[model samples]
Target: MNNLTTEPDMHTALWSLVRNNNKLFSQKRNLEKFRTLLNIISENGTIEDLINIMSIFLYGNNAQKELIENTCLPCLRKLPCEDLPKLDERLRSSISYAGWNINETTDWKQKPSLFELCILACHPNGYTRERAVTALANHYEPVALAIALIRCNDWVSPIRISARDTAVNIIARINTDELMKVWIVFDRVSHGQRHGDISLSKTLFPLLRERIPSNELHLQLESGNSRTRRYAAEVMWHTHQSLNYSDLQALCACSDPYVCFRTMRDILPRLDQRVRTKLLDLVKTKKWAPARLERLRLLMTDQPECMHDELLDALCDRSASVRNFARFHLKEHSDVDMELHYQRKLESPNISTRIAALAGLTEIGSPIVADHAKRWLKEENPRIVAAGLSALPAEVIDNCEDHILKKVTNHSLQISKAAYIALCNSPPLSAKITPYFQRDDLSERQSIYFANLLLLQSRWEAVAHAISFCRHNSKEVNKCGVFWLQRWVYGERKFWMTPSKSDLQDIHRELELSHSNMTEALMKEIRFLLDSYQ
Candidate 1:
């Protein structure tokens, strides 16, 4: 110790002790040297001298924190630049221990300086910078919040998240005079309210709801980006607060299903016992369920028990994503059989519910459930109508004979295509739908339907299916298959034909060569159809 002549020599020696404070402190000789070094720095050290000594102990063993905080923190803050790294460490220590209301309960004057906090907030090190933010939030000091606001745009994700979180908490705790300053800081943020997550509607509403006009918040709720709308919903329900019933109802729309679903997840659990049931009842209207795919997923994931009826309705959701998820949940989790679930949802006013139930029933190989699904033919939503025409079982199509005859003409081509697919998909439907072509009331739509149904041989490949269709058991169906094959083979209407001459010849050769599965009647019919080309 006596051999060390310069201040730098002692500084280097002190740093060595700080790094190995616990290990060195136990030895009698090193402890005497460490105490002598602390005494020399305490008596006559420069800002850098004080900082070097203070940081050594501050970061050393746990037993040294009080000496650094009580003996060194006061003199260090006033240092030039405070040397940014050391300033950062100070802020980190402050954030870890500062009381939320230390300003009021304590002398309130001797806390970490706001200037130090602001500087640390802008520090390059993300780790210490986030900790600085936590300190600002805890201090809830009015002035440091500006730095917090700037951090809302932090380049790193977690830093930005921390800044926004602290800003909200600070704003929530500040006085009106100080809180008003947030708008000024926000004004400087690029596109301020237009951005996601950073918008006032999101970052402010939950914390500063009392200051923001309710009408403006509602407007943002309706028109804001998904994140803004999400937060607006959170604020609205923070203390069981709510927007108008219709607005709450509107939140369930599909345009922003993910957001709508999240808001509902939070909102549903908080409603009064009486209103909760009514809220569930309102969702049953189908309009609520229509576009909310995101809602269904979260509901199914986090709180499946709350979504029982909605899950049932979801089995018929217009969105395949929702319906698929619902079916998965029911099949894996619910004891309820597919038949019973389908029958229950069959009468839901939600046309999708009805259609989905029918689809679900048919999927699990349930018998024809045409009565329940037939009503979907008149559903205004084209999706529901399309599902109705196709998702039914084969016998269901046979029983709802008249309804199919009528719906075939008036609905969309998508629906008509669906009907073609639906009728042909079922063997029973093959017999049932064939009879419709002979009807006197065939409109152009009806004409298209019958023509397509009769001409359609395979849902997958046209030429190959045409040959197979010619071999169908029913004579009318076989005759119809031949007629369409002739149209395709001869140059009658090029639009209806898909197979080339070579492909037809190849099929003919293959058919004659392989006659085992080809019944005598079907082979004869195919031979007659092929004779025209020959």
Candidate 2:
């Protein structure tokens, strides 16, 4: 009976009882061992263990009924409600184990235990579940009722009918608190796979309205676990329950983002003037971006006069969605020149604000944005320079090519990477990048970028670039050269005109000079291609 045992020992003990189930059921001493093992399993076993036990119990013969009812049912009831969905999901996905199927008896005179009925309700066999539904009609524990509610969506019609009736009867008799405890299970199952015509909203909402007071519902919204809080909020909203300013404010401040968003989308617009002002103050302090974005949108729609200041502040907001929302509204609703506004923001000391402004001005395509970008590229701060490089347009890239090329060798990899991406499309700058590979100070990434730039050039120049890269010190860069050479010699011959014999000989000679760096496989492929040309 000691619950503290290793998992392998406990697993062996449980399966031993399952293997000798008949002897365990028929003998008195073995029944004691069965009860003890069930105790250890109920305490220390996992979801899979409990599920295996349930499968055994469901397929038990009449001789095993006493042990199953007296010992197994009570232990199974010890399973927490949270584990039921996991049990249900596992049962749904797997077929019943053939080893557990000792008898197929479905007929019984007396009603089974509530926990027993609950397990049977989830039986993978449809008929077994249907029998459990009928047996469940007389038992109404909260967990039992929740399982019955779940089965109302059973793909089998008779089971769904029996379960819906059982759920309706139990919902009537159960108090609000008891019903609330099972709400998470009921809500989960309602949305899960269902083929029946039963609508949970139509069945449960009326009962919720009759039994659940507004204060209790709000308490659920404020303090329940995530699933319960979502269900409670949804119940209150759909039932058209009126929430006081305090309740609305609490909802807006709820740590759950979806609840906060629903409050803004569904509840905020209908508030009275006094409550609206209070809610607005609370919403302004909320840091979640989706809630803030919805609040800004509502302000634009419901209170246009206050939006000018709100939208301007939002332009500096951390979220791109909020910033873009502000930009669109500012352009549509006000005479304030967005270009001038963003221009002023570009000079702000805050790095994030300056980045946002740079992005905005770039989107506006203002001619002065290039001037600001040129100046920003010269700044000592890498962030501003990186932002400037990202916002620099195609027209201005040629103008700033020298500044960008300098950053390609910058000590900060962030600025260097941004500079490389900006220069990637400028074919004119490719020739200037070749000398950078020879510099010993270049980082690993910078060396790779210089090597990869060869792939963007014409065929003969690319050959020269590959030869130059193979002579670099980094093996990774050398691999990039070998990879391109392999592809050019073996893969690209059909795609382009074959190089002249002298050009091929030149490639062969250069590769031979750098052959110490080439792998044996690469040398063989290059030799074959060059011999063909000869």
Q: What lDDT does each candidate get?
A: 0.58, 0.73
**In model 2, where do residues sit more than 4 Å from their true spots?**
1-29, 58-65, 68-75, 78-86, 89-108, 124-128, 134-142, 161-184, 205-232, 254-259, 270-281, 284-293, 311-335, 349-351, 378-383, 399-534
TM-score of each: 0.34, 0.69
Query: What lDDT does candidate 1 reach at residue 56?
Result: 60
Clash count of each predicted structure: 1, 0
Task: Quote model 1's TM-score.
Answer: 0.34
Candidate 1 C-alpha lDDT tens digits along 1-534: 888877888878877766645675667886677767666765663656664564464345544444444455444433433143344455446444432222232232454545445545655567757766777887655455666766777667787778788888877777765554344454344334333655545555556667565565566567645655555455565534635565555554424555455556766665565554445444444444543554555455556677777766667665666677777777756575767867877767765556667777766667555654566677777777787777666667767656665566554776766765666653233455556656655555555456556445442234444555454445554555556555554543333334457767666665755456455765675565556555
Model 2, range 1-534, lDDT digits (tens) per residue? 366367567656655666645654557876677667666666654667767666556545555555555655555555566677777766654435443331344435655567556666777778878888877877656777777877877788888888877877887887877777677776676567467466667776666756777778778877748887887777666654555566676678777889989878887777665566668677775778888888887766777877788888887776778888888888776577888888898779789899888788777678877888878887899998998888788888987666677788888887988888887886444557666756888889888876776567777667756875787788888888877887877775566466786677667678778888767887786677656656
Q: After superposition, how far is residue 269 of candidate 2 from its true place, in Å?
A: 3.7
lDDT of 1: 0.58
